[model samples]
Target: MLFFFFYLFFFKLSAQTNLKGKIYFDNEPKSNVTVYLNNTTTGTITNKNGEFNLEVKNGVYQLIISHIGFQTIKYNFDTSTYTKPLVFSLLEEEFVLDEVIINGKENNDEWEYSFSVFFREFIGTSEFSKFCTIQNPDVLFFEFDSENNILTAEAIEPLHIKNEALGYDIFYDLKHFSIEKKFTKYLGYSYFKELKGNKNKQKKWRKNRLKAYNGSQVHFYKSIIKNSSKKEGFVINQFVRKKNNDRPSQEELSKARKELSKSNVALNFSRKIDKPKNSIDSALVILKKAKLPKYIDYLYKSEIASSDIIHKENNQTYLQFDNNLRITYLREKEEKGYILRNPFSKPRKAFLQASNIIPLAEKFIIYPKGILANPLDVLYEEYWSYEKFAHSLPLDYEPNNDD
Candidate 1:
């Protein structure tokens, strides 16, 4: 039995594609450097000679390599098309942390408030956020611009977070983070490592992970890829959103109201309307009804099939469409945080998670695991906008109900 197990392990290793690379810093071998494929568990540490061997499935991947005090290297390539070994030279990065230290302490009140804001916007406020702890928040630096009402943050080193809810340890190479006017924008590369636990604990984690997976973006993408979105309890509608030209602009309405307000205490009565209905009310009616909505959206009543938006070219899957896609996952109800943040109430029969997908380009490639080739090529609005890392699974997560 032991011999069979050994054979299986070697067989599996032999089947995987290997990425070989070496790292150097200041013309010297950089040992113990962390090298990994972004967002995946495939990773390795550099040997004393600064060499690494990473194994993964045959696909294109975003590679990351780094060590503290050294500038990180990120490379994207296709494993199936590349045959040459990778060589990287990392540069030194300076750290000036005194200002951040003094800012955290000297202004204790502001620091506390800033930290709270960062915590809510960065790590997020989902149910899983309570179980996710940043192991090294000290490496973070915060700056708030009072005039712009924006908060920006940077980190000297990778941020390590342990997620108890998902049974994973996550390392985020944070590139940028900002929050302004209740909107948050952050960009980063991440690597995930599975946490070890006993059988019972593992069972519970599997349940939790499966729960988080259902109705997620990846799930929706996967269903579309399989052409089973409707069967999987997802309804899609195509809509065109346009400006409501019938509604007057705010400036026009304001100017009209101002002109009426200046009307010498009673001259508004001359503004003819039948029965002399309260001068102010008559003027307001003439000023364009304030109840007119600012935008009008025409939604198609028919549900679209996955094939309408998903296409394959040159053996690669692509998602393309006109206007926007209104997706509703009926299997899962909307998150409580999503409901509280949005203006919509849960309709009696429409208790579902709703999101809108807008393409920033003509179309974007969809990789095998439901990951977008360029995440920024499209915009995710509504419920998707509210979801952060606390509610996410790594791109490489292979789902299984029995996990």
Candidate 2:
């Protein structure tokens, strides 16, 4: 019996041979598809040119083929000594729901945070579509202030937008918002002090420079905005900075330095509207009704600042009763702040800010229009995913939901 077993082992070892093959889609080569012998836990991916080489034994086995957007396929084949080279034709699955139309062209393009409107300049585009759909009323608030010669602003409301898909809510308590052209110290480079350490190293670098002011920005938490399809509150803060590092001559810097030190520096606040809707219009009405700030440039240039919620407390206590015992719980939430310099404020001391807020709604509401309901159907379709089970597209891309 032991001799027979040894013979069988030798035969099996000699029978095993390498299986090589090329995978294609109808006559066209395909790449990145997984191919392997089924039920063996062994597989290999086709190279960039859709070529693959695998090893198999001299026996009948099942072949498996799979790709992200294609259906998995299986086929039975034998690895006999006389069998010729093998070839496979893979077919891609037609995901109709994943299809999108943008000006009659539907190509896969990853969504990014920046967008360009014509030749105006590249700017930060809203990531609302990236936020997961919320079934609750959540609001994100922000403010743009440029009253002082320093031209800094604060966020007076929440940083995360709750139920953002429904609408947006913002509260501004500032009056007379304006963007004024003034020379201000560039504090953004303050980090260099810690980074470089040596005081002389700091002096070797330009401490302050003049920038032709463009605009500013306040960071928004994309994650909070995503889960905020319901009852959510968040905040965003904005900041002002010189547009280009276009250094102002020493003389110009000296002249602006005097103006920067003024107390209660006389400045202007401008209210402008971009893509104004009923909600934004309503917010403007409130701003006007409150006699807050003067309206300056509409679709013009201005300086604005926004702050983020760095710390928060629920200020509430919850009690739970279990049989004869009671449990009370308290929690604390931590937030972070980010600073952004307006990339557009140069060669022109102009900027613009449009303010508005949308009211909350009940149930799963799609506001104004349901243009972005699919989440995957937005202008940038590459950043979204859909689950066969959920029947809804979410920004979350887990391996289980891939293709």
Candidate 3:
């Protein structure tokens, strides 16, 4: 069951590498250790002798080594440079005795509320999400900060999630998860297993998988790397957005709000005090204005090619640009959810699958098959941010002729 049916996963691989490895704990062979490449179906569990083997195409991948009681190890490897018969020693997971979750008891009502928020933000709110289920949701612990209204969650182990829509069972090794009013952030590595189904179900899943992949970030990444954006029905536009000089920075606004609420919220910890009506009204005005956008976004009508913003230096392909990168996948129409959430006032704006990409760093090193060296180096918005586990497909997934 640990095997990924190598031939099936790497059927299209032009050049493949045979990878072999062993796991050890406290100087002894460790069995049943899970090893896999993140975001790909190239995975296998350790055998009785602690040995594992897998085949991968020539590419860079993050090799994940995980066990129930052992500390997880993420080893970055390249098929070209990494050789065979690799050995690893996993350390025991250290338990922190003092770290107790008190929020569940303090805010019992918020437990359901927090899980709802986590499910929406983490699993997503697309049509595919209805078919995704978290099998080990009970293992998740939560912490809610009443003052700041932030929700934090941690899982005792990898989350067992089944995506019936995609016919995949996913084990997600969650590292960080936190949600607040303005932002949500979670980081995890996932290993996928194919779910058996009837021919009809498999065919339907294939169609859905292709639909998810077509206008996705992965598809766009692949197109850019191959310099085939136009051929792939993608329109690239340079987005130049400027900060609103008329508005104060978020940090400044937050400080002002906190200072204004000092007599109101901070003083509540010790005793109850009445907030001055005029001061409270003034704070309300600033708080309402803070909810407005902070940037002035300029839409560019002149479209550009992927090659215009990407460069190759020393054989390493990277994306660098002055502002955000707006992408519109012309092959498919906008997901109904997006269209409903953001209705187009002008008929010209009724385009399919539009997303804005903002770079977190000055440059991002990209690879073939729509992967990035540091995936979090760029941020996504609009349609790109809408899809999650429910719409995910294995990197090796290929469409059948009908799909």
Q: List TM-scores for all candidates, in order.
A: 0.82, 0.21, 0.81
List runs of model 3 lying over 4 Å from the truth: 1-14, 97-108, 244-292, 339-351, 399-402
> Each prediction's Cα RMSD?
8.1, 25.9, 7.8
Off by over 4 Å in 2: 1-14, 95-403
| 10 residues in a row with least lDDT, candidate 2 | 1-10
Clashes of each: 0, 40, 0
The TM-score of candidate 2 is 0.21
Q: Per-residue lDDT for 233-330 in model 3, tens only? A: 89998878887765766776786577676754432223333453555444544555575668888877557877887899998788888778888888
Q: Residues 14-78, candidate 2, lDDT per residue (tens digit)?
A: 26667777788878888887776532324588987888777655655556666645655666666
lDDT of each: 0.75, 0.29, 0.75
lDDT of predicted model 1: 0.75
Error of 2 at 39 (Å): 2.0
Model with the higher TM-score, candidate 1 or 3: 1
Cα-lDDT of candidate 2: 0.29
